[model samples]
Target: MKPVRFWVGLVLVALGVLGILDATGALETGGLLSGWWPASLVGLGIVAMLSQRRMSIGPAAVTVIGLILLAGTLDLAEGGLWWPALLAVAGFAVLAGLRREHSTRTPLVMFGGATTREQSRHLRHTDVSAIFGGSTLDLRQARIDEGATVDAFALFGGVKVLVPRGWRISLGGLPFMGGLEDKTDSTGDLPADAPVLAVNGTAIFGGVEVTNTPEK
Candidate 1:
């Protein structure tokens, strides 16, 4: 199993066990779930860092934010530290973006909605983010001659990626208090040289969906 899926399952099973124990009085959680939930985000961030081919800014940011939130929940830190953390994250993202191809367009939506359609003949990597809003990327008209990667992040919002039907899709990412749904059509019987698209990133308090068809 993929590391992301394994970690997600482990977290869910742990939560289920804890709930059962707490309900039966075999163990007293004492609001542990309510207070320590941010720890899952931390774990997810670490897992993402270790599992992917390269370290991603999204995971690093998630780790830092999770730590801050966890500290605040435990009364070990102030609740107003979000701005500083977010600024740090933005700086990191900018630095990372500088290293990427100039043709790559990083789509970011905040408190609104946006859509991007890629018709590139040599598509490579794509990054899409949504914060308190929605973002969509349509790549059905694009051609992936070689491998490609997609990094998607959604926080309190949603991200939808529509890709062409015959490419091989490898979905990897963590969903914290959120969901990741893959609806891409299978690339059955495709030649070994067929293009491969690897989707990786994080969804916190939101969702990410990849499909070959638009939602009806």
Candidate 2:
């Protein structure tokens, strides 16, 4: 789940608790059809969040439906529907952005300007002449395509690129007690300039690699 989304749910729980207290006449409610309604909605939000923990509710369609239904049930009160709707959208957004598998490949986990992910059981970076890094490859087609637009592409599994030597290669992101970029020659044809760069990250387990890049 998203950090913001989780916190929002927590806020709902707090609101629900207060609502219940008010409904029981122990506290004063602002006259919004008893505190029970708010409490009930909070309960629903909790359920939604919990369900998201194991398996995502998917694609935001269901969440939007629920939010709309909830707003309607609340008699479409003034400025009340926005929060619930936003929560639903945020939850689904996080769900859609996470990786479900531990391994995947496309010959090259290209990460750069318009790096196209060509899907195949054995991915081949025909665009370039060399590979960098010393990681494995050929994973099942994954959900989250780990391509970054401006910065480096992050990796969690591992990467092995076959590129010519002498080319500049930069990568970051390391594993616990593990090395950052272990180099190897998969094709023996390396650029004389050692064109290999491994990008590292602060995270102990995630990493990134760039290879077979033609110098502009």
Candidate 3:
């Protein structure tokens, strides 16, 4: 599936074009298209759901709840009923996280600092969390296996990831009152089928930075 931003941009562009045409009296949607504007949320939810390689309950719940809210917004259902459904979806995501088989060997730094440098041939999946502290993860000496994902969470703290050059990287996640930076250099050539390293998660009142480094 394509990136969520791509689909969202396409939707926004289409809406802008339609609005322009309507203003010029070149086309008539009769307000029908305007009434269905909430469909954009539904489209984004679908993109998020399909972007996951494994079936994740979080994305699935988001998709279903988004559709419900979209229906309510379109007057096809009661908008007042959305809250309870949203709460249920949140609970489902929590439960699914607990039941997931993936390793939970997350590196955590609380009120302190930590640095991790693994020499493993293949880095799989990892999670890093920092609260009122800082953490650095160096992967310059490690080989990333295909489909590797690194989930980083920072709250009133900071996290840094140093990746080797020539690695393909994709980023996702949310930043609120904080920032996420990709300072990786793109001067080196990378293969089309190079292993993928996905960096994602949340940064609240904190920051996460990913930078490329020379191989060690």
Candidate 4:
């Protein structure tokens, strides 16, 4: 994937260079290059596809849209066909997003709100993302696995994670114009074999709060 991204990035850079040369009157094919600027979108879509390890519809849709735009710009396709195809692509992207949200065990909230409370006896890793939204994960009833980690990201939003008592909580993250609070209490006089839960990630213009609560 890294190699693929590198090549795609090179192609984008080459296109940018061509555009710059054309703009400066250094290239004889300046008019053609300027008119065919939609090729840059195709390069961007390729970069997006290669950057992700998992299969995602977002990049695929982007690639398709870029191709359509390129065709339209080159007079290979009618302009009327482009808009309907783009609308269809948008519908498919929404469906794919909903499917991913439903299938994943981890919680992800983007531009919306969600509450996640799984009944697993042993909790492992969980991911949370909140952008212009809020999310809450209640794990008081679940047992924390040793060295479990929570990856969270918030931008103009908030996330709250509630863990059971007696679990050791470690906070390690960066906040840029934001805050990360670990309100969990330490279990004094307890043995050193308690499970550890590490919270790590970033918050920008947002907040994350992790609190300790008694088991149900």
Q: Best candidate per lDDT, number?
A: 1
- Reference-based lDDT, each prediction: 0.78, 0.37, 0.69, 0.66
Q: Write the per-residue lDDT of candidate 4 for residues 14-67, one digit (tens) a residue.
A: 778887887798886666765577776566445544544333442354456567
Name the regions of candidate 2 deviating beyond 4 angstroms: 5-9, 28-59, 75-216
Candidate 3 collision pairs: none
CA lDDT, candidate 4, residue 186:
67
Q: Candidate 1 — what's its lDDT? A: 0.78
Weakest 10 consecutive residues of candidate 3 by summed lDDT: 53-62
Error of 4 at 148 (Å): 0.8
Steric clash count of candidate 4: 0
Model 2 lDDT at residue 120 = 38
Question: How high a TM-score does candidate 2 get?
Answer: 0.25
User: Which candidate achieves the best TM-score against the true structure?
Assistant: 1
In order of appearance, the predictions have TM-scores of 0.64, 0.25, 0.52, 0.53
Error at 188, model 1, angstroms: 14
**Cα deviation in Å at residue 100, candidate 3?**
12
Ranking by lDDT: 1, 3, 4, 2
